[model samples]
Target: MTAHYTSQTDTDRAATETATAPAQRDRQARGIGSIDRLAGRRILVTGGAGFIGSNFARWLAPHAHVTILDDFRSGSRDNINDIDDISVIDGDIRDAGLVANAVRDQDVVVHMAAMAGVQRTLDNPVDTLEVNVEGTRTVLEAAVEASVDRVLFTSTSEMYGDLFEPPYREDGPIAPKTNYAVAKAVNERYVKSYCEAAGIPYTILRYFNVYGPNQDGSTDGYVVPKFVRRALADDSIPVYGSGEQTRDFTYIDDALDATIRSLGPAGRNETFNVGTGYECSIRRLAEFAADVVGRGHIIHTEDPRPYRVERRCADITKARGVLGYAPRTPLPDGIAKVAAAMKRSDRQRAREV
Candidate 1:
């Protein structure tokens, strides 16, 4: 990964270009190559300090003027503090005033702020729905008001809801079992309606199981991070149910690549499933994590979470054809990187102690 070093001069130039006529900028973008489509555009990323959001913001900051609007609820300031040439706003998405202000003069908006996590939703279904649904509406309204060039909404494959189908397609049956999935489904509909009525270009991406560094297993309640952390500690890796549940895990880099590609003209007003068309059972996933971490044990138990998905795999033909997305990292390779990161963190903590 080549580091992107931004200076004050570049920041000043980007700001000047952003303040120029939006019409001219749009024309240039339309005429330019896809690789340079994002250059110097002002972009607002909701929940920009969270796990995937932070990574996307960092990756785009060098090419675009990135402004992050986050409530700091599940996101932390530390995520974006080291990245240069990025603006950070501390506010919630539900606050219409804050969202509107953040949307001002931005060429694009990427809405990722929502109440996520299945177990967390099961614990507080009402709150999850209220926050995720209401927050998305707020962002959509603000985008309409600002008349941003494009808006990207992140949905989840969990919206498919344990359909026992292999390689779920973009037009599969809707069976959202959890409040989190329900909220995402509702938000997807809302985005379509608003974008169609208001004449705003939009793209909806249903991300499959996403895992990488920055995912906090302890607090974020994600399976990969939790299992990896436990494995690194030489603790028993817990498996819910018979450990037969399966998911299509897309590494963060591949996910981010698809996201950036979708920002161009090719993805407008389209819904695509972004994932590797591969399935790994929970038992296998845990075993891989343990193997990567060098030493650990697996323990099976009754399912603790409500409404688990038994099988999941995405048919990425659309993503491949439309966005030119190709997932590169294999499961073991990704797991090895995660384990290496955990080991580094562990060593750092020990030294601090």
Candidate 2:
């Protein structure tokens, strides 16, 4: 990878931008020599209090004018409390008036909110489509209305559900096996059409399995959290299938890095996969997490995963070439980081005694 670098002029401009906008300045100041472009900008992260959104908000706040919109469907306020200065709006993505209100007066719209997770979709498919498909449409349409500078559409790798292809590219077309994936695919369609129709620029980031701190019980049958919770309880980790199904797990920090980069000079009306090209089976990943936590004794279970059988990863060549981005954090290290955070959360709970 090319050495990430910016000039003194870049730093000075970044500093000036931050000084004028307190939130915008702080993120740049926090990063200093790193991730400067995202600093000191007006950013709205829908579902900003959720796992990925919260992490990005924390990373950007105090450096940029940050606004978070979360309807509390799958997000919690505690995830973003560390970034106190951000504007938090408690509203649903489907609320066009509410979302339009949020979209007004924003530099960039990072749309992360949606009816999420496989189990939740299976339980309520209509609600899932409403948020994922209609919600995305609402946001993009509002962005077109508001004339926002840029929008980042958080598409899902699940959009390519059950593709027998390894390292799935953004153009890989296939059917989404579950309601969740289907909704996400629909969301992608609407966003793409809005950008094309209204001359709106956007980045459709097809994220792989993103795991890190503050990821909770939202996504049931999610390998990382499920295994982590079981390990924390000193219980045997559950292995679905023969433990051979694989995923490209990208850390939250790296995802945030790539996301922030997309806000600026990257290609427009484009789609890229945000993932580490490496793949690990659910069973092996669980075993690794167990080892990281100094726990194990996992008993094998049948594949209870709702989706049909398929292996998945990402071909990040486009992201590298266009965005100058790569998954920096390795799999083992990211898992261990989340494992440490899990221990920290446990310790904090114990302290309440």
Candidate 3:
């Protein structure tokens, strides 16, 4: 078994382990043949300064005329601060006038803003509903007013909470366990409703556990980044619920690629699962982070919270069939990139010290 991988070895070294990140970026930067389809198109992305949203901005900046609208609620300036070409508007999605202004004259709108995180949603269900559900409605309405061709709604696997089965799909009943999940589920519905009734084109992307460099571990209740940051600080790898809960982790690039694909002509009102389809328990994810940091410690499992217990794996057939989505980054390789990024950030922090 590899030092990074767990003791239980699998025949499929087929996982995305040894792939180079910058090499892939270089390839995309040079042009992915079909990636520039949205080139010169004025596209509006709500929450474009947040983690996934920021990545989308960076990913599409060279290709599309990206306009980012963020009130800085949970988004960072570092996301669009440097991109002078992309117009960055500091505004709230809840404000209909602001959303209308943001989406005006855009060919497409990607709504990604909401009160994020499981704990945050649990604490403020009202805000979650207001922002995610109501905010989405505002964005869609703005799209219609702006005469946008299509819009993509970012949903979550958490909406499929408590699914004991693997490969969760689009056809399942919505059973949201947390307020965040509830909000996301509602967001999906509103998008679908707008598309069906208003004849507005929309696509729903239900992402699994998407992890990568720019993601705020402190903000999102994700296992990998949480463990990576904690373990890097030489703290105990905290595992809630015996570390038995499994998640289908997808690399951020894969998710971004899928998001971009959704904007294509082939991607209208088609809800697809964007994930790697590889299930890793929290324990294994923690162990990998610890090993990356050269730590000599064990995972400290805590009591499982009632709200979060169960695995979340994605049935990526829809993405495969429609978006031609397939994960290129292996979990180990992606985690390694995250570890490296955090290590660099730690060094920068220390230098400031």
Candidate 4:
């Protein structure tokens, strides 16, 4: 088995910090290749300022003419505020006119804008439905109107809530319990329907637990970032339920790779699961974060959320076979990078203060 944490000397750490983040370092070490086919293409990313969207936009900026349409509701300006050459549009996806304007002349549209987080969705079910489902309708309508070559719709593994299955496949039946999942489920159907009717090509990517830099622990309901932030702050890690619920965490870079590939000719009009297919329990996930920050304290509590899935693991055989998708970052390594990035963020904030 590979070691969770790599043994790096002080010199290496110093050099890495000056040059890049831990996640970037790990990605470079893996020597993963990008999908260069997008060069010279015009692309619009809904919610491109958010965690995953921002990372995807940044990665695609050099290869394509990237435009970001984000309301900054859950997205941060710090994420893409400094990235050059990408046009940033401060707008809402729900506005059909705005979405139409953004989608005009774009070769591809990656619809990622949504009201994420289970609890957040539960609190605002109507908003979730309107923004996630109806908003996707708006984007899809615009895509059809503009005659975009390809569009990728971002779905979630949560749509397969409480499946109790070891690994959820792309063809598996989805029973979404939360508003967020329900919205994503509906969005998937809407995208396919619109694309079929208008002769537009589409790809649906169902992502499992995706974690990495630019993900805000305070807002994003992901357990990994929440635990990492608390552990780094020397606060007690909170484990909802038995802490045994498992999730297949796919790294941000891997997810981006899969997303970019979906835009290519290989994955056209196909749906694939984007994940590592490895299960890591929430308890074990907390332990990793705790270990990273030298925190041993943990607090268990009943999950107050409306819907809680016991386990979630993706079956990425289709993605692997079709898109050549392979998740290289293991849980330990991904979590370690997250910790390093958070610490660096803290230091930068301190200096700014």
Candidate 5:
């Protein structure tokens, strides 16, 4: 397999350091600069071409040596094309030889690869299970054999389902209602067992509705991006069921910061809920998107899914106390940012055409 490698110049490094000096100082003052601990490490990010994974890899490229292993099934090359310092390995995580090669000599492995989307998983249950469960097993086993310092696995809050109340805590019970959630929950168990048996350090991050720029806005995409896309096009925004179902919409930056902090000492062998503690109903989310774009009208649509979670709000108290995780962006602000980004992307595409 052919691999693409890029390197950052001294001038680029200097410029980045100068621009981020103030923010770095602020983080240090707040005792949350644990993310600085990852500097100079060799890190392998599985699925590094996807939305969250690509963003994380891009942000960390200047600070560390980053390698991305992705099959490009659900990931796009455009996501990582702009970054000039990361190494890209085009392959699948399920390929043991490929995974072993990627994991070798890496100090950290951030496993964010998985078959995502609720409707997509429902439509292809068997493929979802095998890719998520088996792919995760392959990555974790490779990490163990490679003797990587730490392995961080990204999970979803959907595993909590609708059984319990809102503001789900980390230690609470998980009642996964979807095929994708079931696979993620099972992968969590596998990560715990495999890491523990091999005496490896691991961290499991259960992310809520993480959305921002670079997010997929297709039909099978997340709510925020989909709503933004429709609003930008002046199309009617769809609200499922009574639109009363609530979710904790965490911004992309906040989620990335939390994940970075988890690589520090406080997050070893721990599970943390990465989300804002606030909840916003689906109706309100649609309204926010419309208001942000200054277009589109809200329209109620029937949700055909049999299993749906009525409420999802993460109790991020554990994350705060443990990782000093503080989410700064509110829902409206985040929606505005997404709208602005989509408009910019539209303009870019128009110019290209």
Candidate 6:
């Protein structure tokens, strides 16, 4: 992961050029013409250096003036180093003064900075609560003070917990079993309450297992990337318990499309489930990952967590009807993309070394 730093003046100038540049041709080529509505808008993306956040920021950068606020805790500089003309604020979201400064003059705030990962949150529950809940509160307060046009809060489908059946809906009851889910669930309520009281429009997006390029495949990363990493190495892919636990694995592009649509008027002040209405078992996913990479074998392991959701899928009827949110990528195709991206990244790293 290479790192590059530029002065604020340079960043601001580049941003101005990017905002003023015509992007219709490029947008059409990238298939992101839907987000052209955001052209010339000023947007702030907290945790814009993380996986989903960084991808969203990169997609939005070509169309809008983007500012990223991250403390570099879980987010890496490598994830965002190549993005041109992005203003980055290196600070904690819990810092009220810093958050206020970041939020000022931004047309929209996409709050994505939070302590993520199920195991990590379980190990450090207090820090997770403070960062995810309190940090969100600080961002909301700042957004209200700055009079931003909208606040988009990113929530997790894990909040649905084991109590819910498959095909979870936005209006369905949430029974969060993990501390990470609890923090996100609480933040969702905070976003709604704070935005309503302040008369600020808000959009809540509950994302399922979002995965693709730029995702972490380290010891504490998501299942898809982790599986890909091991498969590439011809190592055994671990499956917890009976491997029957299912998840709605939404690819990054589809997730981004849903997110961009949420910023428009059609998605105003509403919660939407951002996922493909399909369920894939963990065992099947592991097999697909190995097959995509052309290597590796599957191995079963004891479920470490005290509780686990057996099946989870999204009911995207609302998102589809309201925002025209349609997921175009299939699981096999998405996994192939991830494998290809990892190979390219490996080649780049080898050259760097």
Q: Which stretches of candidate 3 lie over 4 Å from their true place?
A: 1-21, 24-31, 219-221
Which residue pairs show backbone clashes in model 5?
none
Q: Find the 10 residues in a row with the least total lDDT in model 4.
A: 1-10
Model 2, position 305: C-alpha lDDT score: 52
lDDT tens digits, residue span 1-353, model 6: 11112212334334423442333243233435557888999999999999989988888887899999999999999999989989999999999999999999999999999999878888898999999999999999999999899999999998898785778888889998888999999999999999999999999999999998769898788899899899999999999987988889999878988998899888789999998988888988888888767789999999888778898889999999998888876786677667767887899999999
Q: State the lDDT of candidate 5 residue by residue for 224-243, as single tens digits.
A: 99998999889999999789
What local lDDT score does residue 309 receive in model 3, on the 0 to 100 scale? 47
Cα lDDT tens digits for candidate 4, 84-200: 899999998989998999999999999999988766777887888889877998999999999999889999888898855768888878888787888888888898999999898
| Model 1 Cα RMSD, 1 decimal | 9.9
lDDT tens digits, residue span 1-353, model 3: 11134422222222323345754565375325446888888888889898899888887888889899988978899767766579888887889998888888898898888888766666777887888888888898888777778888888888777754766778876677887887787778788877777788888898898889757777345667877787767888777657767888888888888887777777877888888777788778877777665553555665645566468888898887877776777776677677667777778999999
Worst 10 residues of 2 by lDDT: 1-10
* lDDT, residue 68, candidate 4: 97
Model 3, residue 140: displacement in angstroms? 1.0
Candidate 5 local accuracy as lDDT?
0.86
lDDT of the candidates, in the order given: 0.82, 0.75, 0.76, 0.82, 0.86, 0.86
lDDT tens per residue, model 2, 128-188: 8788888888888889998887788898888777655777777777667888887778877
Off by over 4 Å in 2: 1-35, 217-221
* Per-residue lDDT of candidate 1, residues 117-185 (tens digit): 766678887889888999899999999999999999999998887754677889878888878888999
